[model samples]
Target chain A: MKSTLKKAGYSRVQKQMHDVFLQFTSKVVFFIIIMFAFNLFFAGHYTPGGGFVGGLLAASALILLLIAYDRKTLFKMIPIDYRLIITTGLFLSLAVPTLSFLFGTPFLTHQHTYLQLPVLGEIPLHSALLFDLGVFLTVAGTTLLMIALIEGEES
Target chain B: MTTDILVLLPIIIPMFAGLIMLFIGRRPMAHRVGAALTGLLMLIITLWVIIRVYNSGTMVTFIGDWAAPFGISVVIDMAAALLLLSTTIVTFAIVVYSFQSIGMEREKFYYYPLILFMLTGINGAFSTGDIFNMFVFFEVFLIASYVLITLGGTKIQLQEGFKYIVVNIVASNFFVLGIAYLYSVTGTLNFADIYLKLDNYDGNIIIMTIVAVVFLFVFATKAGVVPFYFWLPGSYYAPPMPVIALFGALLTKVGVYAIARTYSLFFIGNSAFTHQMLLFLAILTIIVGAIGALAYTDMKKVIIYNILIAVGIILTGFSIMDQTATVGAMYYLIHDIIIKAALFLLVGFIIYRTGKVDSERLGGLIGQHPLAGWAFFIAALSLAGVPPLSGFYGKLFIVQSAFENNHYIAAIILLLSSLVVLYSLIKIFINVFWGEDMDFSKLKPVKYDKLLVSSIGLVIVSVAFGLGADLLYPLFEMAAEAFHDPASYASYLTEVE
Candidate 1:
């Protein structure tokens, strides 16, 4: 497979130029996506959108990167394992409910409190938001994993 | 509240363990140990919950802080507890059996995690008190099973798995539609709430009956009963042994459990009409399953038919809709889960050692693999409803229920089908175990001790369940009573905290 690919491969200069342009566009898209993802993630606690949507948006950004560049290039750019992200997210999400058990609440029973921070003003903290972050990471990780796998398979 | 918290353990333990196993990556030994430990913990937790539920009656826990009717609730009744226990038992056995049975490559591909996730779904489905929550859990298990089925990415697995997914997706749509219709009409999704609303609704019963039929079709498809059962044998035939064992043991039973739960709780409004339809479906399921079993020469396909027979039997008990009949059904359901797992695992062993699934290429395995042969013999007998085995009691109770209700045709059919079940199983036995002793050298040599022990563990459980039925009868009685009276369960929603 590699020999055939090498034999067919040509015009490295054009490919590099295209990748440079693609990289430029993907970065812009990535920034906008991150902005929207975090916006949705934070706004979710107060409104309609939350971790799932943000996570999905974030995943879409990753998918866009895959489409713009090859999986190998994208992996080199991100340098992060999606599977590990998924496991971390799962543990985080699981920990949210588990924390409640420590406080004699049922699984997934969340509470909100106000905490004064020196750098930031009084912050309203809901344990569920943490759980939502876990959900975000999980959804994002799994979605990216699927895309990465299929991309890897095709390449 | 604590009891409610306890009900969440089965779901959480497996979910957590499965998640943990995901990170264990590529280490087959670690995955096996992690999965086995998880399975054992789940079994212990399930048994504890069962004992607690048996002592205290049904325990209901709402998810988060939301109350029943508004949020998802998990209810651990005698029936649910029994199902949970059976699931954990089979899970533990299969987890152990997978060490020798499942390929190492499959192990590295998150096999253990998928099984645990599936168990989480099964446990949640059984214990959830809400209808929609049941749907969510059903999806959980279905997706997990789908992944497990296609793990090898074999051509057959992929082809059959696609069909399985399509069928389930359609059935799930019907399930959701049914739930939507019921919710729109009754304005509730809680099982108990629906029971109350259904009882109070004085409007036209026709729409409700239609909803019941839709729900029945959905569950019947899941359970692999007649007319809707065409997908089972082919799909189940594709997966590896331990997976097929898990599917044979727990998956279809989850569907049966859903049917029994909904029918007992909400379908009683038009019992005369709805139940007559159910009885006809049940009898048809039996006849079709038996015919399919008799027609199949392949070991896996034949076992798949036995699974259908179990489904038909459980549905028959539900269709009879009497205390005795429900008890019989519950007994059979439990018996079948263990026995079927044993049978599937044994067949998987036979296939692995002999490299043949068809009895035509195999003969006289009892001469060499005495333990497996005997174990298969015992499981086959139990499955066939032979006397003093657990299967016998379930058949007996159903038969007695039929006689009591003067459904002589049903009784006769039940008896004749049991004989057919015996004949079909015996044919496999005679062909594979008794005739034309083959040289042991020609067969692939592998470690059979662990797999044999796991198979025997369940076979012994079946025998003990049978002999100890006198002691276990009260539990079944309580389960039956709980099935008969939804009011007792419904009252929980009205109890002011």
Candidate 2:
């Protein structure tokens, strides 16, 4: 059957199936771990955990996927370039505060505004969140990129 | 709006450019676009910073709406702004210069983002009001630099880069430990807040002294002072000329700026201990750096050693603790960045032409490459403190200020070091440019690339600074004013809040 699969162009599909199964299972387990880490990060912000830890957790999720699957498969799964993630993260981090300069305020001046949604309720969008999201993306992207480079070199 | 933007713009503009570059940097067209946009944006922002700093006392920005004591802020006084302006200028020059010197393969990958990130770290370090934030930014910059330094993955680069990374990591760990102790003592990361809190606390002088000494060691490693400077010559000479030029120009200066800021604001109260230590370090650094310069035969090594000399001079300014001495330090810092960058770029050009940086194999290119030779001569003279040039003014100011402050020993060491620097630079000039004409039959005539020419243009601007000192002196004076007046920075942030 393996020989048949290899000869019939099913090898690619077979390998991909094996890869996908491994990735999906690991991702599930990894997602749970990350969710746990995220909760801990949120609770520990005033104590220890913050953007850096949260970002590291997200990166670890990607690392888990990389471990379970091939680079090409993993690259396909994560469509956005790690560089873009890093850059966008940095931009978001820098931009939120820069907006304050426009309003004659100092940089990174966190202004909170509650947006009235049509049905859900009021959503509080604080600039600090944007900065945190930026930090998250940068850390995750940078970590993933480093992992990718090391993996690429090793292969 | 003008003043606030002026303060924020230098940092914001480069950051934005950096972000934009990250997306489009893979495309050939994007490289040009990124370079042009970054250069233009930097130039405009620097000009705005200069104008605003001259007109309005100092600019301050608070991050996240938190007041000065509670949250992070970025303050851009004349000194910070001037450093920002120079950083932008050197980055712009190097980026333009990279167009030709860096291969297309490299430009597509690391060149633009690394530079932009480097600038971000530099600008962040310069503008940040929080000491911890300064450390964070320093890490940001250093991490990028580690990548940039090791970008090509050559054996020599890998070896030297490893040492550089290890040394910097150790320094960083020390920096973090210092911050921890500082926070434990003062319970604040804000520079001004720490200053205000520490002013009243009569803590154990011994603990404070140890922390201060540790802080000095961390910065000294970064700034390439004396015993901590071995990594600089080897690592700096490992990378391509353009990378080395940028590193030579800005990295140590950022370290020096941190020292200057910390010493002036937080540590000023303990001047008797801190200043004396700095005075001793400065003199030792000068003597050691000059001797190193005399010993090294490689052009890059000599330049790196000269950077140590510049560090010594700048430290001497910091050590004296007088207003005039600080001003001299400020001027010297600015002059050193411009001249040293120019010198490194000139060396890059020579290497590009000669296919070698060693003086042993290279000879008699003065006539063949007159432009490169003369540029090297001017930059070397400026570095050695030749009269009527930028270097001379900086050395003269420091010497005068040191003498006025009764630091005659430091003054004399500075002067004697300048003479030693002169000898080493002249040694390069004689051997590389002026000695007997070597075999040219096999040698390819060095074609001056446009990027190389643009770098020379930057050197020309530094030379112009020398020629037009009268015009630039007022700006330096304003910068001196800004550094001395911590109240202005603190009050500005508080008022905004």
Using TM-score, give the best candidate's number. 1
> Fraction of reference contacts reproduced per prediction?
0.61, 0.68
Candidate 1, which segments miss by more than 4 Å at Cα?
Answer: A1-23, A117-120, B2-4
Chain A TM-score, each candidate:
0.80, 0.69
lDDT (10s digit) by residue, model 2, range B212-264 = 88889999999998788878888888888889888988999999998888877
Q: What share of the true interface contacts does candidate 2 keep?
A: 0.68
lDDT of 1 by residue, B1-497 (tens): 64256888898989988888877777778888898888888878888987888898888777786877888778888888888898899889998888888987899889999999999999999988999999999999999999999998989999999999999999999999999999889888999988988887888899889999999999999999888999998999999999999998999999999998899889888999988888888888888889988998898988898888788888888888888898999999999999999999888889988988898778888888787788888888888888898899999999999899988998898889888888888888889999888776889878777888888888888888889988988888877776767677776787743
Candidate 2: segments with Cα more than 4 A from true spot: A1-54, A72-80, A100-105, A111-130, B1-3, B445-447, B482-497
Please give the distance, in angstroms, between residue B427's alpha carbon in candidate 1 and its true position after superposition: 1.1
lDDT of 2: 0.80
Q: Cα deviation in Å at residue B450, candidate 2?
A: 2.1
* All DockQ scores: 0.50, 0.41
B22 Cα displacement, candidate 1 (Å): 1.1
Q: Per-residue error at A44 for model 1, in Å?
A: 1.1
Candidate 1 interface RMS: 2.0
By summed lDDT, the worst window of 10 consecutive residues in model 1 chain A runs over A10-19
